[model samples]
Target: MKKSYCPIDTFINVIKGKRKSTIILHLFQGNKRYNELVKLIPDISERMMSKQLKELETDNLINREVFPEVPPRVEYSLTDLGKEIHPYLKGMFKGGIIFENKIDSEEN
Candidate 1:
């Protein structure tokens, strides 16, 4: 990928899709199958989940491994690149809490 003038915009572009960040955050825990991901994130549809997974795979953020079996076994886990960004994602979680608290206080 070519270097963008705005580094933050470039970073956001990679993870801009719906459910992308959440999906990555989940995979940070460990590998998960398609159904497992669906269960973990109730609001997301199967189609949307599939789409986001493909995009993440394309971006080299996650790995999708398929096994030979009667029913195909597919699992998703973070790639080295993905692992490299895990700390930042965790920091986002902390910032999210702070943002949420501010919103709550404002509404009260």
Candidate 2:
């Protein structure tokens, strides 16, 4: 990840991608196989999911483990850094709800 003048920028840069934060939040629940993630985030295309996973792995926020079997099985789990960031993400989630509610009220 590139250094930013503000730490928030760095944080945003790491998590910025289509459904990247969502992917992290899901993996925070437990280790998941690729297909499981695909199912959990049906809105995201398989190709985009793959790309986000690769980027997350590269950022050291998540671990990708591949088992050697007839057909390779891969699972994703949050790394220490990923786990550490959960509180911040949780805050964001709560803040988002507040904003969403405001928007809904305005639309009515």
TM for every model, in the order presented, reads: 0.94, 0.97
Worst 10 residues of 1 by lDDT: 1-10
Whole-model lDDT values for every prediction? 0.91, 0.93
Those runs of model 1 whose alpha carbons end farther than 4 Å from true positions after fitting are: 1-3
lDDT, candidate 2, 8-53, per-residue tens: 9999999999988888899899999999999999999999999999
- Highest lDDT model number: 2
RMSD of each: 1.2, 0.7
Error of model 2, residue 25, in angstroms: 0.7
- Please give, for residues 19-60, the per-residue lDDT of candidate 1 as tens digits: 888899999999999999999999988899999999999899
Model 1 Cα displacement at 23 (Å)? 0.9
Tell me the lDDT of candidate 1: 0.91
Superposed Cα deviation of residue 83, candidate 2 (Å): 0.3
